[model samples]
Target chain A: MSDAERLFESLARAIIDADETAAVQLSETILAKGFDSAKAIERGISVGMEKVGDFFEKSEYFIPDLLDCAAVAERATAILRKGLAKEPVSRGKIVMGTIFGDTHDIGKNIVALFMEAAGYKVLDLGKDVSARRFIDAAVQWKADVLAISTLMTTTRGNIQNVIEQLRLDGKRESFLILIGGRAVTREFAQTIGADGYAENAAETIRLLDKF
Target chain B: MTDISPKERLDRALLGKPTDRAPVVCPGGMMNAAIVDVMNKTGHTLPEAHHDADKMSDLAFDVYENTGFENFGIPFCMTVEAEALGSAVDFGSLECEPKIQKEIFPSVHDAVYLPIGAIEKTLRAGSVIQAIHMLSAKHLDVPVIGSLTGPISAAASLIDPMTFLKQLRREKETSHKVIDYVVNQLISYAKLMADNGAAVISIADPTATGEILGPKFFDEYAVCYLNKITDAIHEIGVPVIIHICGDVRMVKPQLQKLHGDVLSVDAFVELKQLKTELGEMRTMGNLSTYLLEFGKADEIFNQAKHLTTKGIDVLAPACGLSTSTPSENIAAFTTAVKEG
Candidate 1:
């Protein structure tokens, strides 16, 4: 096998095992050997993350497994990004956050990681995000998708508020708004006029891909 | 049947014995029904009710009086146990439920193990106990449910949850220690509630789910720790209700082994199928809160009737109720169970 193919295999294997040390080592090896960073990210890290996503969807990997894989991919991607000649071509820019009054963000965080691994530039606004902040970030970032999440039933309404504010601000058509979480339903998504709703991290990427 | 008190009805239903009908309720903690309409109608608002025992009792009673829920569920939100364990909690407004602002520790290894009985001394725990006492005294016939955050969830609340979840595999030893400590504290807390006049204790562990922990950790940590609390509550002669949030399809076998008398599941799990699979196990819930919040009253009533026909022991919300959920919809839900 060629050197680049071997390094890609090793990098992907590191992510699947969720081994940060091996991921970092292989990332450094890729840079030192002067392989294309974009190809390394696409073939090595993204393929590994997609596999991780598959494991999660199959219930073979749970939240902890996904989080660990995300951590590994995150560290490896950081090293690979340093070797990029210019900004890599973006699939799209996405803004994500847990809606206001909700502190839970694990689901949102996982979705953000998956989107980034799939080559979307994600601006994660973090948890307890207000409608104003969500609108502001999406407008400033010129994001294609605004992904909102909330775990609590009480806070899910904040998602509707975000959608309403977008309309008032004349930016409702600018971004395709998506909502998901324990509290959000596909019916709720449609009722609130959201563009899309996904049930899990993998489905979130699939939905965004179709758009 | 007409003479059956709420407590008697619930106790009988929980035992899988013949009851006048299914006991309809919203077990507190995560499934609390202290909605805005009830609070606003009574002028006993939250953020205040969450801390003041009298207001808490009054609001819980008002929820029962107005919403058609048959029991009084104290300490509306799930943050009581987390706050008692040193996590910074944001006591949200009348409209928003409380949420954990920051965990006390960053990692399981860094967790400061408080004494087993330390939770009893916390003010929030005191308020809950006091509220249970007040409700028990004021409404002798109605059951006052004491809600607890289960061990895995309480531990996750103490340590940064992201770090805690990852450590379930990475740092098994410390994870066990932290959750064990949290479980011990929960046992004492449950006992305190029992002693304080909580007729039934409900433990809602949203973090301990088949989807999140999978079967292995769900067995090792979630089931183990939850059974510890359940056994302790059982030893106190109090009935236990265990709510496992999210999907349980992966851990259904392990879940069958839980000592909790009533198994409350999320909205998606078909309670009828669950009842058939886990025979003679009194199942509590599977009603969609989304329907209660957004759907029509007649539809909610139809769904409630569907659950009743399936012979669910305890009729309740599948999970937490939205603060903005209409009282009329909740009324329709409970009415169907009552008419059965």
Candidate 2:
């Protein structure tokens, strides 16, 4: 294998192993060698994240494992982002947040990080975001999809509230609506007029492909 | 079934002893059942009762009296322990529960050890204690469960959760020190609750679950700290009900090591299956709060009946209740358990 291929393989393995130091070291090595950092990210770190997503789907890697890997991937991204920021290649655009009255954002944050890793440009409006803000961000960003997440059941109604607001503004058809969190279910998505549902961070990225 | 008091029924069921019927109650923190319509109808509400002992007890009573829950769970919001530990809080509006606006320490390693009794002396913590005292004194025949945010959860709240969790691996010693400090504070608070007449102590450790922490760390951290709190509560002659969020299957082996009086699992694990797996250790909950919130009244009742037949020792919402869950549905859930 080529030296560049070897470096990329090691970087991907470091991410899967949740080795932040190794990821950072490999990223610096790639950049120092004048290798394409964006290529390194997409071929190296992103490949590892695909494995993380698969582990999640298979229930082999849970939230804690994802968190560790996410932190590792983030360190590598910090090193690689200069090139990535300029090129700005993205598969899809999504605006995501937890609904109003819900400050718990771990799930939302995980999805956002993984979505970014998966080549999606995500505009993250953090926790306790209002329905108006969700609709407004989606429209402003010209997002292909809007993803809403909440751990609490009380703010769950706010998902429907956002949908209703979209309909009121005649923008309901403009963006695909995806909803998930601890409290959300497939039935809930149907009940609230959401276009699709996701159970976790991996599924969120998977469902976004349909949009 | 012979008529028995709510206290007798739950207490008996808790000890893995025979009971007239399985007690269906809602413990606070993550399992809070104080919905909006219940508050609207009764004129007893949270974000207000959350700070006053009288109002807190009044609402706790209202939930039991109106909703048919046998026990009273107090201090409706989850941010109390975090607030007591020096996190800035935004006590939410009438329709919302409080949330931690910011942590006291920016990182877990920065966790400074507070003087003992520090948590108990906080204003809202005092209010929670007094409310339990009032409720237990008034309704001597009903179970009064004083709920506390579990130790890891309290620790996570005081430091940024993501950072705190990373520290558990990266900075293991400091993380344990922080969790130990939180556990000490919880024991002090729990001791005060027992002294003040909290019949049972319920812990909702949503952050300290196998699904979130993974199995090995869950055994090392979640089970270790929860066992400390549970052992202390047991020393005070009070039964403990501990709720761990998400599927418990990952940590099922470690769960057997847990010493809490009752182990509460979320809806993903059927109590029947848990019964077959764990055998006779007394379990509570598995009712899907989503089902309670979105399902028809009959649907909830049927689910409750199914759980009843599964022989769940105590009936409760799988996780916290949504404020928007209709009173009629909750009423049906608790009512079905009682009637069936």
Candidate 3:
């Protein structure tokens, strides 16, 4: 294989192996070799993360494995970010958070990881996020999609309140609102006026890809 | 059948012995049914009930009497174990369940191993034990199930959950030590409950599911520690109920290895199929809480009938009831199993 091809392959392997040290070393090597960092990320880390997502979809990779992959990809991305241009291209901007009154975020974290892996810029607002914060973050980030996750049935109504707040703020039309979590269902998503509902992280990426 | 009491009915059903019909119950902790509708009707509410034994007993009785559930389950939320273990907890208002505000340790390596019985000395544990005693004494015909936050979840609650899950792979030694310590504490707490008149000890470990831990870790940690607690509970003379939240398709083999008298799972699992797979196992639950929260009474009743006809040994909510869930829907659920 050509040298650049070999380097990109190594970067992807580092991510798939969830070897943060190896991924950071490979990204450093890429930068030292004056390779295109954004191309390296799009070609290498993203591909490995896509594989991780697929493994998760097949139940071959559980939460810990997915989390490791996300951690490796994050570290490698941090190294590569320095080499990219001032304005590197992204797939889209997505704002994500666990809805108000629900502190569970593992599902949301995985969703954010998959979205970022798919090349979207994700602003994670963390857990127990309020409707106002969600709307403000989406508007401030100029997001293409607003993703809300919740785990408890008690907190399910808060997702509706988020959508309602967006409408009241006159910003409902600006971004697509997506909802998912253990408690959320496709039928409930429809009932709550959510634009889309995903069963898992992979489905969320596929939905975002379509739009 | 004529002399059957709710406690005897539940005990028999849990032991896989025959009864007039399935005994519907809400195993507190995560599956609590002290919903707003019930509290409103009875005028006994949470956030206040959580800390006072008398109030807690009254509220649990209110849930049992109003919702047609057969038992009194106490300490309404899962945060009790976490709180007693040194985690910062936010005891939420009436409409919201308490949640861990901050884990005491950021990772298992950083965890401070408290003395085994430290949890028993906590105010929340005291309240729960006192409440269980009061309920079991006052409502002699009803069983009082003491719900415990299982070992894996209790360990996760002490450390940041994300960090803890990752550390289960990265820091196996410290993870085991911390979890073993937590299990010992849980045993003490369970013993305290059993001594104070708790008829059944239910363990709900929401974090230890196959989907989260995979088969390998689920077997290594979840099953191992759960069996440790279950054996202790059994030695103390109360039947143990083990509730592992989420789909168990990945961990069916490991799940079969659990020693609890009754195995409770989430709504998505097929309890009938599970019973067939694990011969002679007593399966307790599989009702969708979402339906109880959102569906019409007839729909809830029909689903309850479906589960009943499937021959599940014990009838209960698939998972935690939403605090906002309408009483009529929960009534429909319990009514279906009771009437059948």
Candidate 4:
């Protein structure tokens, strides 16, 4: 096998193991070996993250491992993104945040990572995000979809607030609103007037594709 | 006998005094549709009223009045402490229970140091204290229980579970420091609740239980800190009741060793085993939320009878009832307790 191919294989293994240091070292080696930046991200980082996600779903990998793998993938993605941006961007853009009064963001972050791996340009608005901010970002970025998440039953009302605010402001139909979280059921999402709801991070791409 | 208050019945049971019958206690874990309907009939709604101290206390009283549960507690949700710590909470609609917004703490590093005065200014904490105050004032005849999240759960709220767990694995000192801060804040809150007349401080530490963390992790992370909080609360003269959600069969003995006076079990566990393992210490719960949410009145009655037959000192739903649970199920369980 070529050196680039070997480096990609080693980086992928490091990501599955959640060995961030080893991942960084392997990523640097791949870059030194003149590996294509986009290919490294897709074949090295994203491939490994997919395996991690699968392991997590199967219960072989828990939350801690997922976080570490995500971190490594993020680090590698950042380096490749910088190099690849000189070329044309291929993915569509998405604006994501947790609804107001809902500070939980891990699920959203994981979803964001999955979206990025699936080739979506994610603009994360962070947590405790107000409805206005979500709408503003969606409008400003002309994002195809605005994804909002809330883990608490108490803060789920904020989803309605976002939808109502957008409707009141006459921007209701401008961007699709995809909502998902522990407290957010498909029925609840529909009742709150959300455009879509993904069951988990892995299903996010398919849900977003519906719009 | 008709005039005997639910509080009085519970007190008699706690004291091992013979009653006209076995006192039925809902134990403030699950709230089926029947309970919500009864609560709404008594003029309480979700979210808005759940956070309003007077509204919650009134609702707690209604649980006793309508269902004949031996005792009731206020602010029926668990996120009060985390919400006070600045974590965003989703107060679900009519069909859902409130939950913490998980996206707020994207990483463990996002867990900012809460200021010394932050706890005092938190909306949820202030409301909870108010609920405790109102319950204390209104229910002098019954034991008023105040619930709080444990340190690990609070840490989970500050950040994601994965991030928090990762921190425990990689940054032990930082994790312990964060836990220490959380424990101190919780102790102060527990003391305030106790001072306001909470007869029992219910420590709801679901995240610390065996379902999520094994016995070893529980020993290192949950038991020691919980013991500290329990001991502190005990020093103030109020009993502690530890409620660990999910299957806690493994940690039953360790929980018994904690400073808590009562150990509440979840429905996933068998009452017969808990009764044999727990021996003499007071215990409550084992009713399934799914059963209460979807089962017929006969199912609730049978479950209650089954739990009573196993000798649970207190009867309650195994865990907090899903917000959508049917009221008849709760009423059936409570009614069975009264009849028993």
Candidate 5:
């Protein structure tokens, strides 16, 4: 394997192993080797995080494993983010949150973390986010995809409300409305006129890739 | 089988005794059934009823009366215990349920262990207990379920969830202490509800699933602490129902350790498969709340029929019902179970 390829493999393994120090150090090592920062993230860190997401999808990784992997990716990416800030941003801006009335953020957080690694600039509004705030942020950020999540049935309607507001304001055509959560389903997405629906992180990546 | 009251049927079913029919209920807090139809029809909306015992009781009754659910569930949102404990909660408007605005502390190291009595002093806690007491006293035929957020979720509510979750691995000693303390507080809260005449104590631990904690920590924290709470609740003469969110496959081996009277799985799990694994331990649910919230009434009724035939001990939405769920859909669900 080439130097960058070898470094990426080691970095990916570090994320799979949930070793924060190893991930950080290896990430720094890659940068020192004059490796392409974006390539390192996509091929190395992003691929590593995808494996974690896959483990989570297959029920092999639990919350701690998922969180630890996300943290490792975050730690490593922090290094690359600084270097890449001056580069041309290719991945689209995505605004996401656990919709209003729903407080659960684990699922949303996982998606956000994975999206960040995959090169998307994710603007997370956190939990209990209002329909107005979602629109306001998306408009202000000029987002490509507006991702909404919720764990409760009570708050899932807020997704429709946000979408309605987007359509009412005539901005619906501008942004892709992607809805997800424990309570959100493909049927609900279709019912509410969402542009896309992902059941978990892997599906989320697929949807974003398509977008 | 004699035609028993809904409360009797639920109580008997919970205790492993024979019942005429499986009592369908959406216990308040996480599984609240106070949909917009019922609230709009009654004009006793939330953010108002969430604080007043009478309004809370009225809304609970509205759910039971309108939807044909055989029980009255109180404290319509899961944020209550956390809010009562110390966190700030944003009680949403007419169409929205309450939510935790932010956790009180940053991490387990920063946690403030409140005296258990402090929760009872909160108006929200009082309203939950009073609603349970009122329902239990007023209705002789319908069960009143007093629900509390489970330990891991409750602990997450008390602190920044992301930070607290990381501490579950990094800060082992403090994390266990924090969880143990949270579980104790829940036990005390469950006792108060039981002492106030709650027929069943329901605990929803969405954050404590094997999918989140993995099997080892699921066994270590989720099952261990839930068993503690259920053991304590059982001592108080109340059967406990435990709901774990997400697919149970990750934690399947640890399932045997969960001691709640009824093990409620989410929609992702197969109830028949869980029953086969459980081998006589009562299984409560696996109904799709997504279908309840978005699917047609006929489809929901058909799904409910499918779950009923699977021999689920209690009929309930797979998880919490959406506030916008039409009353007719909920009625179809309850009607299917009651008719069975």
Candidate 6:
């Protein structure tokens, strides 16, 4: 194999193994060796995390390893992204956050990482975000999707509030709404009028790909 | 009229005994100073100088005095085992309770080994052993139950749960090795607790149940490890109670066959369906924690009565009550068990 191909392959493995330091160092090494920055991110970091996500869905990888790999991918992506900033990017934009009154963010954070790695411009609003804030951001960013998450059964109603306000404000059709988290089921998503539901981070990517 | 001591009432319920009514079982939810004050008013005292130990016993006895519960559980928190394992924990005040810092284990391989002599020396371990000792000395009249977290759950708290779950996926063999080692440690602890004076050993493994993993992963990892621990504890002749949080309907059949004397369900599970599915194994719990925390006394009573009608062998909280849950809410649950 060519040296660039080998470098990209090694970078991908390093990200999957959750070696953030190695992933970042490898990205620079690849760039120093004259590989394209965007190609390294797309072929190395993103592809590596996608494989990690698949392993996680298949029960071959657990949460800790997935989190570690995501961290590694994020570090490597940050380094590669600086080089790509000089050029205009064509990735779709997304607004993501956990709904109001819910402090849980582990699941939401994983979904956000997957969305970001999948080449979406993620606008993370963090936890305990209100409905109005979510809609306002979606409108401001012209996001393709507004993904809402809530881990508590008590606060899952907030997802519906966001959907209702968006519809009332006449922006419902402009962006697709996806709802997910531990307490949310596919049935609950349909009941709340969300466009889709993802059981886990890997499923979120599949849903976004279809979108 | 029939004769029934608190211990005898609990024993009868476990044996499917017919009694005056369904016996109330406190599955380690009776903690906090508020509960202890009521128990002290009803003639209970701290078994030892340790505040948590004294508080646990007093809370258990208080449930009996105020609500007429049939069973008294000591060492009301699950963190004792994790603390013993050397995990740093912050015991939140009466309002906050205790919690392990989320960032305790930043990496999957950061010395995730269980400490040597962890079963014998930790403060909470000593507390549990001593609590049992004191309960046997003073409260032989009532069944004194002890609680411990299953290996997987304790390990999750010590390390990061997300990391541990990922390790299970990436390195199944290594994960099993860790689980097996931890289970051995737990079995030793369980036997020691039983020998010290605990009549029933309640195993709380909320993280290893159905909510986190589907049946495929559970059967492969959780079921076997739990069976080994339960089997060892049962060999010493102590009854084992398996408690799993979340909706465990899919795992009820597996749970029934795991050699535990009773299976405790969280409120999310439908007790009627569980009863029909398991057929003869004793089942307890299904009172919503939120209802107990936020709802009125009447709601707690009605929910407890409703669970009893579904054929629950013992009445208890679906999971540990939040520290902020009012003492009145627990009283309402115990009252329903007494009247029903």
Computed on alpha carbons, the lDDT of every model, listed in order, comes to 0.90, 0.87, 0.89, 0.73, 0.85, 0.74
Decide which is better by DockQ, 1 or 5.
1
Candidate 5 lDDT, B1-340, residue by residue in tens: 6778888888888888988877788888788888888888999988799999999999888888999988888878888888888899888877777777888999899888888777788888988888888888888788889988999999999988888887787678999999998888888888999999898999999888776788888888888899999999999789989998877886788987788888887887888878878855788886787788789999999888888888788988888777888889988888888779
- lDDT of residue B136 for candidate 6: 72
User: What TM-score does each of the candidates earn?
Assistant: 0.93, 0.93, 0.95, 0.71, 0.87, 0.71
Q: State how far residue A82 of model 1 sits from its true place (Å).
A: 4.2
lDDT of 1 at A138: 92
CAPRI grade, predicted model 2: medium
Better of 2 and 5 by TM-score: 2
Candidate RMSDs in order: 2.3, 2.4, 2.0, 6.4, 3.3, 6.8
Candidate 5: RMSD over Cα atoms? 3.3
Worst 10 residues of 3 chain B by lDDT: B272-281
Model 1: residues with Cα > 4 Å off, grouped in runs: A85-89, A151-164, A182-196, A207-211
Tens digits of per-residue lDDT for model 6 on B1-340?
2667777777677767786766777656222222443534654543332235665555565655664455556565556666666677655443334555453564346636665556667666776687777777787777877777876787677666666776766557777877776788788888888888887888888678664665666777778888899899878888787887766766665666666777787777877777777756688776887787779999889888777788788777777665456668878888887777
- The sequence of per-residue lDDT tens digits that candidate 2 reaches over residues B1-340 is 4879889899988898888789999988778767788789989887888899998999888888878888999879888888988999998766777788998997876888889789889889999999999899988999899898998888988998777776777678888889999999999999999899988999999888887888888988999999999999998799999898887887889888888888888888877778666654689997888898889999999989888998888988888787778889989999999986
- Candidate 5 chain A lDDT trough over 10 residues, lowest sum: A81-90
lDDT of 6 at B214: 56
Q: What TM-score does model 5 achieve against the real structure?
A: 0.87
Q: Rank order by DockQ, top first?
A: 1, 3, 5, 2, 6, 4
Off by over 4 Å in 3: A85-87, A190-192
Highest TM-score, which number? 3
Residue A115 local lDDT, model 4? 84
lDDT of 3 by residue, B187-296 (tens): 99999999999999999999999989999899999999999999999997899999999889989999888999899998989998998877656998978988988899
| Reference-based lDDT, residue B327, model 1 | 97
Q: How accurate locally is residue A172 in candidate 6, as Cα lDDT from 0 to 100?
A: 90
Top candidate, metric DockQ: 1
**What proportion of true contacts does candidate 1 retain?**
0.69
DockQ of each: 0.64, 0.50, 0.63, 0.18, 0.50, 0.22
Predicted candidate 1 versus true structure: per-residue lDDT over A1-211, tens digit per residue? 8999999989999998999999999999999999988999999999999899888988899998888898899999999999999989999999999998888888898899899998999999999999999999999899999999998777788899999999999989999999999888999999999999998988988898899
